[model samples]
Target: MTEMLVPTELLTGIAEMDGQHDRLFQEMLQVKNALLAVSDDDAHGLALLSRLADDLVRHYAWEEAAARRYGVPFADHAREHARMAAFVQAKIDEIERGVCNIPALMVFMERKFESHVAHFDLQLGLALQAARAARDAA
Candidate 1:
């Protein structure tokens, strides 16, 4: 699997979140590669996809916990996460039914992930940083 560099714009300035984002990107790349490979074993690709879905769920839970700890408003963020999870599951179903366009699906997922990091996650990161700074200053 080719290593994908997380763009600087995607960095949330929170170490753990950044690391998770990196891992997620790598996992997505692996899934894309596996699907694109000219092999009869699509089982490997499907497994990778399932793992990516699971990792995303864990990542979302971690972020939600951090948001609560930092006192960031989380209802909207949690709703967005739920929507994304549902979308991923639907896509996985499509893939399982052999109706997926692998490249397009990968591209869409990558863009959606990047947009979420930029808009939602970055806001949460900023809130977390401010909360920590305030606590330290007290």
Candidate 2:
């Protein structure tokens, strides 16, 4: 069994964001498992990768919206999101062309996501919590 990409310590404490993160990791794990299976057909893994990419786009948009709502500075975070999306797409393309190293790509993506959540997403989570508290206190 593959280890979880997002560990407990990396959780943002924001319900929706955490859920989305979990889903993204789960999808990626599924893709990894599919690819590692002893089968010639990689169609299922490819489809999962595509779906993961789409879900990541949606997650990024959700985070941006939350950042705006909570007055969190988002320019850097959005840029990071864009970069990650591009990287994932490029890797998917490489996989299609039979040029990708699946294990290395998975390791890289896991580390990248862990760092992003620990830094950017955690800051956004704090901001969101603060904003909600302020609103409730009014």
Candidate 3:
């Protein structure tokens, strides 16, 4: 009876980023569960979704800032963040448009997270790790 949005094994070797990934996954899972629960209180579900959106915005911002600071030469990495932000916003909009299909949204999130982790998340994490090592040795 464990509810996890993204498996911990998906987290790469960066500590702060991995912690953020875990928190984001756990928060999204909580929101999905609350939305699917047989309860009359929809407020908690709404709040969690809002918080997720806010956290995503902040996380993306911080990630892009780090890339800039570290001089990561991958242009696709920043574009990936923009693409994901748009996708996530679109999902949130769909949910807010009187759609109660939490199951469908969860599926979409799972697919999105899988692709994102494999691509942009891992790239950023690896780049940051390299950057940190270089800085430490210098």
The local distance difference test score of each candidate is 0.91, 0.89, 0.77
In terms of lDDT, which candidate is strongest? 1
Q: Which run of 10 residues does model 3 get worst, by summed lDDT?
A: 1-10
Candidate 1 structure, TM-score to reference? 0.94
List ranges where model 3 is wrong by over 4 Å: 1-9
Measured against the true structure, the TM-scores of the candidates, in listed sequence, are 0.94, 0.93, 0.84
Off by over 4 Å in 2: 1-5
lDDT, residue 111, model 2: 86
- Of 1 and 2, the candidate ranking higher by TM-score: 1
Q: List per-candidate RMSD values in Å.
A: 2.1, 2.5, 2.9
Give one digit per residue, the lDDT tens place, for model 3 in 19-105: 677778887788888888998787788788888878877877777787788998757766877787787777778777766577788
Cα lDDT over the full model 1: 0.91
The residue pairs in collision within model 3 are: none
Identify the superior model by lDDT, candidate 2 or candidate 3: 2
Candidate structures ordered by lDDT, highest first: 1, 2, 3
C-alpha RMSD between model 2 and the true structure: 2.5
